[model samples]
Target: MLPLTRDQKHLVDQILAFTTDHVNETGPAVFTVYGDAGTGKSVILAHLFNQLQTAARTQPNSPLTQTTNYFLVNHPEILKVYREIAGQAPHLLKKDFQRPTTLINQLAKGQTTADVLVIDEAHLLLSQSDHYNNFYGDNQLRSLLTAAKVIILVFDETQVLRMKSYWTEERLERLLMPYPHQHVRLTHQFRMQASDALVTWINDFTHGHVHHLPKDIGTHYDLRIFNDAEQMRQTIVAKNNQVGLSRIVSTSGYPSTLDGGKHYITEGHFHLPWDQYNYTSTPWAELPQTIDEVGSIYTCQGFDLNYVGLILGPPLTLSPQDQLEVHLDRYTDVEAFKRRADITDKQELIAVKKQLILNAVNVLMKRGVQGLYIYAHDAHLRQFLGAK
Candidate 1:
């Protein structure tokens, strides 16, 4: 078992105290665990759940004896599948899996009575304005709080990807002020190399704060920025084959054309290739032939590998005034158009976009145990890396 970090242990103790105290009083307790992406929020929750399960089994009358339900608000389809497997009534799953209102209503119905409700991706519950008409109704965080005796919401407000209404710290505090809750924060990062300067740079750029790490005590990462696509491809292939490292390519625009030779010959993989461009797949696979086969930044967020090669597509160009415009356009749907429209200032939008790219880059960079290879088309970005 991986030893829990100090923050993790503190979180667990707090949860235990909250649960025990609430159960003794026969009341509900709301707890929010906030942290940045890759801060091991889910891991801590899982560990706590396991401990609660063990305690429930050993002491049947324990306050944590209420059925534990762990739900991720991001993917509703998976929840549907789980409901089916659990033999739950169809109506139970109808509660807007994405919305806090639906979740609260469902929990209140007593069909799924959970003593401890663990909500992952709680950042998805920004505010009333942050939601779509089809999903969240009224307030999501407030609705979720109404559901369970011990509600554990794990999220990072700074990592809010989709903006319904603009969110600020003042707004978030007001939203949570009504609840009798304890706010716990996790700071230690177990995944990244302690000495990694890029991690510091990216975090500082994104959050406007610096996260200090020990000097590269372990394997130092090599940063390479390239402008030529072919040259970048060649370098990634050589690195992957020679060192058995995984390669990832990120693009803002779907490639209009894909080189078949590079797709099959190179061991490195691409992210969301099918979504970006048209490609023919080989006989063995059902999906189109694209770098998405290797992995995507979304799929690989909390994961780590021996090596990572990142390719930034056109959207990441230094010249684009609306840097995050491409990212928001690519990730969200048409319904989110109004939210994007609210972003009026080009420079502010570009700054947000830059932060988004830096976050994505941070995600890719931390994946490598020993090395990171970057291929960027933007000349400014290349210059930033001091690449030849």
Candidate 2:
């Protein structure tokens, strides 16, 4: 298990105390952890949930001795990791971890409630019914909130990638307005070794701004901009061979289909298929064979990598003013911008689509803990990025 920082430890202690205090309360209690990527949100949830389970199951003198609880995550890749961890933990069982939809369905069938629910990647929770996932609820979080006495969740609005699960601070605040709640924002980045300037550079770049690269960008982190996509893949492969967990990922505007066939992402000589759905128990990044596959936001989100090679795909272009532009026509991820009944304004819909595209870029760029290597499909954008 990963050790927590002093502040993170204090967060755990505070949340545990809050849970104990609200266990027998009349209405449901909510604890919302707000943080960006790599802010150690998931690790805090992991440690806190473990302690809750250990105390509820083993500590006879503790107030949580008999309290029932569950740990949930909307991402399947992340859920696999937690369940694997639980398999080895003495106090945590595999059954203790589940996807939010699964937990919600089971609770509905049994008409039962849990004392506590700890959720990771809560931003991925479905805000609308997704029949493909068998979720019939209007909102997964609302369902979970209704079924638990206390809900502890970590959310990042920037990580919201799809229209089906679109979220904002305002939307979340409105949902929790009826409940008793506590909110905390964690600012320190615990994953990347990059300096604050480099972090800000990435944020600005994804948010549609292009600035000259910082001179000290590589002092603490490996920052590289490659003119050749093939060379970038070679460097990432070498890094993977040396350090493990390094993978090449791309933005969504690639040739892809959901027909269960191999869809290749070819940039010059760097040709490989997009990451296939993993049927095995191991996480995608941990598999040695995955180094040849190009990961997407779905595979890499909420997971850390030693190094990431990012391909800004066809949808992104550089304007005359050097501003970054997103073209909806070139974006092939049709499912990402599916029309929602509640969102009907044409301008709002376009803005959301562009933001989602940028959100995917932001997520891929932040996956690297030690380094970020970038390549762009647009020639002008690539030149702009590589110039500095």
Candidate 3:
């Protein structure tokens, strides 16, 4: 059973009431629920799914029956789990189910004319762009809209990472303009401590604006900064032993200053080099290995853990200028063009990268339920916390 936060329960009630009222009166409509990462957005989706399933089971044989289908839309991680449950090879399932066209067609044929299409991670929907094209033309949201009477998309625009065309207010408006759309902004964060501070900081850093939350209502975790990786790892080990707190190391697969020891957990059990670019493969042995540990943050996104130890590597720096220097090479695929791009100036690129890295770090830091231990490799960056 999935646990629902108070806000999530409220959102589910709203969705159920809306669906009940509009089950008979709709050709097509879109409902968008947007929030930051680790904000219980997915829990709301899960609760809605449960409600819809119950309605389908209990309702009489009526045309207004609920035909609900849930998809996390193109998340490789979720897809792997789904394949395992179906007893199919991951590669085979990828070939069959990875393409939106194939999956949608299969869903259409198998399902009983879906009344609601719930799409998680909807921020990945590509905007109108020529340089970068979604395999399905136009937008995936539009395609899903064609198939379902009520299309519900849940995503955080701020969490978009790999898409060529970033999601913006203008782009969202344009996409839903043709249809009757209602936008629901989720402001209450039940997951993170210091929610207001984190949200305000991230919004200002990325969008050049600030939006405030009501109050910081959750538990607070200590944000510790360390200059050396060895100290950080030792601290993590000690913390685990002292408090019996579950802990895991989350890094971008880079060696710390501790004599070339890798700080981050890799994907599989194949013993690949730490510097290897590809980190996608997962062996059967590694599956259990992941389960045994305290749970690493790199793989813990879209899920929750009791405690998290985040090792912010050299790519992140909080400088004396009160500016963040984030190196994008750790998280993005644009490393190849860095050599020749007009914006080749390292300082300028570092500034941009700093903001990006800070946002990502903030998201990761907020994922813990009980505690967060931050280990900063750069001493200058450590000073920014100011005795936190």
Task: Give the winner by lDDT.
Answer: 2
Per-candidate clash tally: 4, 0, 3
Q: List model 3 lDDT by residue over 125-204, tens digit each.
A: 54432233224344566666776677677767565543333455556778789987777888776665654665465456
lDDT of 2 by residue, 51-121 (tens): 99999999999878888899999888988999999988999999899898898989999955688999998
Worst 10 residues of 1 by lDDT: 277-286
Instruction: Report how far off residue 328 is in candidate 3 (Å).
Output: 4.1
Pick the TM-score winner: 2
C-alpha RMSD values across all candidates: 7.5, 1.2, 7.6
- lDDT per residue for candidate 1 within 1-388, as digits (tens), equals 2468786788788887886777444335677787765567766765665566556655677765535544445433223333332243222232323334455555667756555666666655545544334444455656556655667777665555444533444566677676667877776556655353565665653443433323453455555555554565566566656765455545333333234432221213422232232222211111323223444443445445555666655554443332322344443123223335646898887665545544555555566655556665566655554556
Ranking of all candidate structures by their lDDT, best first:
2, 3, 1
